[model samples]
Target: MIELLGKNLTELQAIIVEAGFPKFRAKQIMDYIYKRYIFDFQAMQQLPGNMRDWLTTHCAISIPEIVTEKTAPDGLTKKLLLKLSDGNQVETVLMKQHYGNSVCVSSQVGCAMGCVFCASTTGGLYRNLDTHEIVAQVLLFGSLLKERIHSIVVMGAGEPLQNYTNTINALRLLHEKEAFDIGYRRMTLSTCGVVENIYLLADEGIPITLALSLHAPNDAIRREIMPIGAHYNLENVLAAVKTYYEKTDRRVTFEYILIDGINSSIENAHELGTLVKDFPNCNVNLIPVNGNEHIQLFKPSRRQMEAFKNIVASYGVAVTVRKEMGDAIQAACGQLKVQHAQKQSE
Candidate 1:
C-alpha cells in the first residue's frame, strides 16, 4: 500500500489522478489526514463509500507503532521506541520546556557516525529511514499528546545530513501549512560536520538552525573521538559553517559534548572560542556527555562544566550548557533503543 503520510500536495494530486480519481479528491483526503489527523479513510465520512473503499485498498496513512514508552521522573520528558513496518526501531523524544514542547526525531534506524562517546553507533549502521518514517515519528508523538508540537530537533539516533534527501523532504512535509506548519526557524538539524551537505543546505533557502557536533577543539582531538573528523577537518567544517551563515544568516549552534577528561578542559574551551570568534552568528552549546556503560565515557562535573563555559565566554563567544533532562529514563539518544533491543533479544 502507498503510504500517504509523507507525500506533499503535488505528489498526492499525482497519485489521485493516477488512481482514476478527480484531482479535487487529493485536497479532500489531505483535509482528513493533515488537518483532522484522521488516518483511517473510512472515518472520513464526507467521502463516498466507493471512494473510501478504493482508498482503503490503494493507500495507507502510515504511523509507527510504539513498542515501548518511558516517562522520566520529572513527568515532562518522555521517550518512545517506535517499531517500523519492517521491524527496525528508532527512538523519538518529547521534551516539555517552559516555552513549548519540542520533539526529537531520528533520521536513521542506527548510526554510521561512530562518535566514541555516543551509544547510537554501538550497534553500527542499519539503514536510513524513509521520509514517511521520519514524519511518522513526530505525528505519532503529537497524536499521543493531542496537542501541537512547538518545534522539532532532528538530533536523535543518526547523522541527519547523511540521509539528506529524506531528511529535507520530511521537514517539508512537517512544515506544510495544512498540517503542522512548524516554522523553519523552529526546526534544528544536527550533523557531525558533513561539510558538503552543509554547503548544499546553505543553498536550499531553508532557515532551519544547523547544529554541528564539534565535540572537540582541534582535528587532532576530534579525530580521536569522532571518526567523521578524519575526512572533514575542523578548518573545512568551520568554512562550511561560515558559508551556511552567509547564505541563510541563521545563527549556527556548535554542539560540544564534554567528556570528562577528553574535551572539557579550559584549554579546549579557549581553542574552541578562538575558532568561532570571527563568525557573524554562532553559539556554542555544551552538553555534558551522557554516561553509557557500553561506551566507557564519563560525564563532566558541574564545576568542570561551568569553568569550561566561563573560559569560552571570556573569548566573547556565546555559550550555554544544555540543561540535563530525563536522566532517570536514559533520555540521551539511542540509550533507550539499545536497551530495548537488548531486552528483546534476551
Candidate 2:
C-alpha cells in the first residue's frame, strides 16, 4: 500500500488524479488525515463511500506501533520504542518542557556513524528509513499528546544527514500547514560532521537550526571516539557551518558530549572555545556523557562539568550545559531501543 502520510499536497494531488479522483480530493484527504488526525478512510465520513473504499484499498497512513514506552520519574520525559512495518524498531523521545513539548525522531533504523560512546551504532548500520517512517515518528507522538509539539530534534538513533533526502522531505512534511505546522526555526537537525551534506543543506535554504555533534576539541581526540570525525575534520565541518550561517543566518549549535577524563578537561574546553569563537552566530551545548553499559564512558562530576563550561565561556563564546532529563529511564538516544532488543533476544 502507498504510504500517504509523508506525501505533500502536490504529491497527494498526483496520487488522487492517478487514482481517478479530482485534484480537490487531495485537499479533502489531507484535511481528514492532518487536521482531524484521522488515518482510516472508513472513518472519514465526509468522503464518498466509493472513494473511501478505493482509498482503503490503495493507500495507507503509516504509523509506527509502540512496542515499548518508558516515562521518567520526573513525568516530563517519555521515550517510545516504535516498531516499524518490517519489524525494525526506532526510538522517539517526548520531552515535556516548561517552554513546550518537543519530540526527538530517528532517521535510520540503526546508525552508521560509529560514535564509540553511542548505543545506536551497537548493532551497526541497518538501513535508512523512508520519509514516511521518519514523519510517522512525529505524528505518533503528536497524536498521543493530543497537543501541539512545539519543537522537533532530529537527534535520535541515526545520522539524519546520511539519509539526506528522506530527512529533508520529512522535515518539509512536518512543516506543512496541513500537518504539524512547526516553524523552521524550532526544528533542529543534528549531524556528526557530514560536511558535504551540510553544504548541500545550506544551499537548500531551510531555516532550521543545524547542530554539530563535536564531542571533542581537535581531530585527533574526536577521531578516537567518533570515527566520522576522521573523514570530516573539525576545520572542514566548521567551514561548512560557516557556509550554512552565511546562507541561512541561523545560529548553529555545537553539541559537545563531555566524557569524564576524556573530553571534559578544561584544556579541551578551551580548545573547543577557540575553534568556535570567531563564528558569527554559534552556541556550544555541553552535554555530560550519558551512561551506557555497551560504552565504558562515564559522566563527569558536576564540578568538572561546570568548570569546563566556564573555560569555554571565558573564550568569548556562548556556552551552556544541557539540562539533564529522563536519566532514570535511560532516555539518552538509542539506550531504550538497545535494551528492548536485548530483552527480545533473551
- TM-score of candidate 1 versus the correct structure, residues matched by position: 0.97
What tens-digit string does per-residue lDDT give for candidate 2 at 62-98? 8889999899988999999998988899999999989
- The sequence of per-residue lDDT tens digits that candidate 1 reaches over residues 99-185 is 788999999988999988877898888999999999888888777888888899999999999999999999988898866889999
Deviation from native of the Cα of residue 185 in model 1, angstroms: 0.7
Candidate 2: pairs in clash: none
Distance (Å) between predicted and true CA of 179, model 2?
1.3
